[model samples]
Target chain A: MTFALLARCGRTGRIGLAIASEDLCTGAVFAHALRSNTGGSVTLGGSPGRNNTLACNLLAQGYAPARVLQELRANDPQCESRQIAVIDRHGRVAAHTGEALTRSALHRIEPGFAVLAGAAVKPSLVEALVQSFTASAALELDERLLKALESAAAECATPPRSVGIVAFGNQDYSDVDLRVDLHGDAIRELRRTYDEYQPFAAYYLERGKHPRQAIPQREFADMLYAGRSGNTR
Target chain B: MTYSIVARCPRTGRFGVGTATFSIACGRRNESVRANVGISKSQAFYDRATDPLVLNLLAQGYTPQYALGVLEAQDPDFQYRQLGIIDRAGTIGVHTGRDIGPWAGHAIGPQCVAFGNGLAGPQVVEGILGGFMAEPDAALEDRLLRAIEGGRDAGGQASNGQPRPERSAWLCVVDRGEHPLLDLRVDLHDRAVSQLRRVFEACDRGHLRVDTR
Candidate 1:
């Protein structure tokens, strides 16, 4: 019913997650990121909403990804129905797919990222996500996450109802947070939205921090629409 | 160069504007909303000040048509401007300046006015109206988002046998307070309207927040 990837960018120390689900508003319930850049976490299946926050809190307290997973399994009575993934600030990755998940449920833990899918997701989809993320090391963290998600979504048997991607940079807030809460073609829509947002990612970060110094949004649009360099300032 | 929709939700008395353009920041200079008063969008050789002025006029109990008349009488460059104005009473006024360029037009719908200049065709504005009217029972922000997406899908800005992409887009909705209920902008993007939709969805689901300040 849900698939997710949690990753930390080795180059920039940014942590992010991309997720899709047959359920509605999956990102709102499953995706969690620590503002302090401690790491990112995603919990799918039963009791995800609560465990997601708990994982983030433990990560913020300097718990390793494995230790965080252990705590989650120990505390939750229905851990067998849940799938969890955590990526710490050090780029360490850990994931769990409970025995009660669908037979196709699978997970892959790579160098700096973890991929987890449960109930209706195939092992091939997990492989595709990891492969795409690993091959796109040159791209930005958000781009890699999106690309990986796109790849995995393409392999899905049925289109998801909702999809979300989030990335936290040096700032306290998420640098990139895009989602399609309920769409027939959520992954495609998410990809289109991400492409449209990529150019403004840095501009938004600048505006968030130094709004007075940054060019006004309107002026910036005017410059870009005119085919002039918007970065001239 | 731009397409815009300015609307007042009759049920909630909320005002909103959805706009996109080949130019950047279409909402910043083009859109204005005054909570209980009305909403205005001034584009096509736009004067950023005009939107607030129109809203101020609406706040003072002037009709949207009268406000347009005031702008026509006062602004020397009025011939180069396009505008869509809607009052709290759901009264609508729109102008597509003759000098704004080819395919410029506007469509007045129930509680909404869609207008654009340098568009692919008249269908762009019509598409906006259709999209807004398509979902009357939907949330105001969702309707506005769909309206702009409608415009983009109907062929947005004009091109030379090539597809013209919207580089910037914005959607804003204001209710009772001095602050807006929703304000999202894509300062620059190839698929500006689509990006705006993404942001709107995130904000709608509480996954993202737009700094109103």
Candidate 2:
């Protein structure tokens, strides 16, 4: 019912997550959190409970992504329906999906990146997600992570019901968090919403720094997507 | 960063708010309910000050509309904020600032108001409102959850629409008690909406139930 990617930008040190599901409110139930100068984790699939949060805490404590995932899998009673991915501050990544959950449950790993998807998803879609992420080196971390979701969701036989992406940097605050909760095209909506919010992302940071001031809001010309338009070929 | 709805159940006199956001633990800051008084939410560049002020105004016996107006008048950043209020009497008020994100808007329904910013289009407001209205007889928490689910369905641009998960979701509902009768949250999870439902189902129904080994 779902797939998610948890990764950190080696260049910017920002943590990013992109997720999509036919299920409702995947963002709320799934795992997410990153400590600044520490690490992050994402829990998805069948049994996403407190263990997901435990994974994140372990990552924050300086556990290697693989070791944290290992400890979680061994401790959890129901590993068959769960998917988890962890990334350390150093950008090392690890992922696990319960094999019993789906015939097609799979993952793709690359340096500084990991893609985890459930059994219902085709391997091709999972590959598309990672390939898209790996190919988008020139784009910002948010754009890259989002395009990967767009690519993966595009391959579904029926367009996914929902999709979302959240990215946070050196601070615990989000640089961008866009969710197309109930859209015909969640990724497409995310693109539009992200485009709109991108210009003002810096303003929120400033607002935090100066809580008393009525910060000025300005409009900037939309940032153009270069080679990657997020359209399915 | 946030969008939410706070409403009262007519038959039961219970209060609840459904909220979801891109930020972590927005529930702790965005929601306030005085048992049977009222509820209000501030999002799209949320502030720590708004919910508390709305709660204080409600405590002073301010109507939802008047309370929202006063809060808006006092805040210089009101233009960038989206707020919705519903008192225990079911009086409803909502404000969407000019400088709030594009597609920023709200739909005021009878006994409730749904609002948000950073949406794919104005349809998101319509979606939340319609979702809330669809299940008129369900529990307030379920109704709010479904309503926001409608927002997810309302998300995405034109064609090739994809449903997006609510990044973080929370609900607080009260029965005849002064404290939150059912307080549940899914914080910044990949499947926050689902987790929210799971926890609520376990916690609701006149008793407390948590899965413990």
Candidate 3:
């Protein structure tokens, strides 16, 4: 049950999420960010579920990182197995990995880069993945997300027998942004899949043909809606 | 006991070999024999020393014959050593030294070469190479194993089936490509070549286990 989350936060724009797991598709219970790049958040997979609705409200209310962390820890039922990576509009990023994650798991933290890679990875993977995206030389959010996946592959404790990558933004679009999956040679498979989708970004913009598959209704519609309707409204 | 090998698979257009004889600078001694040829096996008894290097060098562009020639020339007492080669066209070639211990010989066939020294007779290398060439369509790993079995049947090692512990044994092969698709090693094992083959199979299957989650 490896979990991950990646988002793009534009100062005056949107905050979105893209995540994938080794079990069911993440669409089941993944939550989108609220307007102002803060608010409710939840991502559930299988028997274990992760949510932070209260923490999002506190963050929106301008709570500090340390406070948010403390709030999260206080509510965590299985602190040792949980993991999280959060990046706010201000570029404030926070992460956590439960000790319960597999022993091979490792998290790396750098100024603009954070990485968590391992088998049975915990919440810490979010931090490392986001960091890799932030530090990559990719030109766009999509490219950054792809790079993060590559970084994860390079640092994975045991080479993932399979792999994938996903990304989302608060932009009000009618289509999904990214999705990748592989059954054989994850590195090569993901890279190829990413290439296939690359044209969608520009092609959609050029021919006005946005792909219907790219959009995740919850994040695209709700997240962008809240972001656009300022608190004053 | 220093061991060095350099060979090529003519049919597959691939070349490589690696050898080590429990001594420091073993690679250097083997290197002199290998010269600018295919590859030199100058290390502890590790698998892939010769095959990986051969495949890599072939990818870098070196003929099968020239590659084997370099290593052969370097060994002053060529008769006492072991060597094998398979050219780009699957032309097999090999030479085991007369000075080589009790069991030293080589076998050449349509597209395979097999040779070994120190326990057994020329029949060992001949049997393996003949069996390998006869089954040209077999999987690479399977063919390699068959060759090993042939060597064993021809009085493998000096152990005489006594299960004498050995520090090392090795096996290597090349895909029909520029780079070696697999390189495995077991410094110590009851059947180094066999174990190396198992690891190769695992790597091949690793990609097939996908996680759609």
Candidate 4:
């Protein structure tokens, strides 16, 4: 019903996750990120919201990704029906796929990233996700995660209805949090949204941190337009 | 309390709305948009239900004027509300009630309508239309974004002798799907329009990398 990729940027230590699902608001329910410099978690299948919160709390408490998964499996009564993925601050990853899931359920873990899928998602889709993510190592964490999700969605039998991507930078808040809660073609919409949001990420960071000196948005747009016109000449 | 633009893209048949205000979460209570149907917005002494109701009526094949009429007939506080509607065919309807206060007005253009209350002046609506029409070949989302920026540049909302900061802003566009093609918002910020601009620009640049540790 859902597929996701979680990864950490080797250079910046930023952790991010991208997910798509047939269900509505998958990002709101399944994805959780700890504060800046910490790791993140995603919980799918049964009791996702509670499991995700517990995982994040554990990650915040300095527990390793493997230890977080162990804690979840030991405490959750319905762990057999759940799929969980955790990535720690050091880019180490761990994942769990329950036996109660369908035969297609699977996951793959690499050095700095992990890919997981719930029931109805084929193993081939997971493979595509891993390959896509691994091949895009030179890109930013957000783009790498999104490209992996896009590749998996392209291989999926049914198109997803919702998609979300989140990346935590050095700030206390997420650097990028884009979600298409519901759409007939959620992955495409998410891509479009992500593309449109890319240029201003640093600008927003600047404005958030230094409100007085940063120029206005209209002024920024004018500057860009002027610069483009100048270059053409 | 807010200035907004509701429009239908002639080239793509997409519907879009952009709004900015002195309040927080202005988009949550002010916008109702359905793909391949129409777009609606309610502001001033805003009612959250008016937008969806107008969109519902448009989906049922009613005219934008008829939808406005329905709202006027049903709501006892209609006089305090400002509303705008654009149907799938690009027909637009707008109302600025008597009780909406100073600088309340609206402007109707080729395929869109700009409306607001508690604004700086009529220039705000005029600037919105001007900005939208300036870029005929741009994407609907981009055009709507510029339209709101134009409004902000023209003056935006004001009270007493001072201009009020745009505390919140939102841009939404819908294509042929049940959900929106793009829904971006900046809430509870002093310079929400600029913040929204940054978000919109980031969507295009695709270069948001994490800072080095």
Calculate DockQ per candidate and list them.
0.04, 0.08, 0.01, 0.03
Report the TM-score for the A-chain of model 2. Answer: 0.84
Residue range A8-127, candidate 3, lDDT tens digits:
434323344444445322222222222234522332321222344455666778876446656776777765665555554554556666677766555444442234443566444555
Looking at model 3 chain B, which ten-residue stretch has the lowest summed lDDT? B22-31
Give me the overall lDDT of model 2: 0.67
Q: Please write out the lDDT profile of model 2 over residues A23-47, one tens digit for every residue.
A: 5445543223555567777777543
What's model 3's lDDT at A110? Answer: 41
Across residues B21-111, which tens digit of lDDT does each residue of candidate 3 receive? 2111121122112222334332212222344455445546666556556555754434433455444444444555554344445555554
What TM-score does chain A of each model score against the native chain A? 0.87, 0.84, 0.59, 0.88
Q: Could you give the candidate ranking by DockQ, starting with the highest? A: 2, 1, 4, 3
DockQ of candidate 1 compared with the true complex? 0.04
Which window of 10 residues has the lowest lDDT sum in candidate 2 chain B?
Answer: B156-165
lDDT of 1 by residue, B1-213 (tens): 688898987677788889998754444332266677887877666554677788888999999999999999987667777888888889999888786557789998999989987788989999999899888977788898889989988988775445567877877777665445566666556677887777666554342222332
Candidate 2: Cα lDDT at B117: 64
lDDT of 1 by residue, A79-157 (tens): 8888888888899998898998767788888899888888778778888988899999889988898898888877888
Ranking by TM-score: 2, 4, 1, 3
Candidate 3 Cα errors over 4 Å, as ranges: A1-117, A121-233, B1-81, B91-93, B159-173, B176-179, B191-213
Which candidate gets the maximum DockQ versus the true structure? Answer: 2
Docking class of 2: incorrect
User: What local lDDT does model 3 show for residue A195?
Assistant: 60
Best by TM-score: 2
Instruction: Return the TM-score for each candidate structure.
Output: 0.53, 0.57, 0.38, 0.53
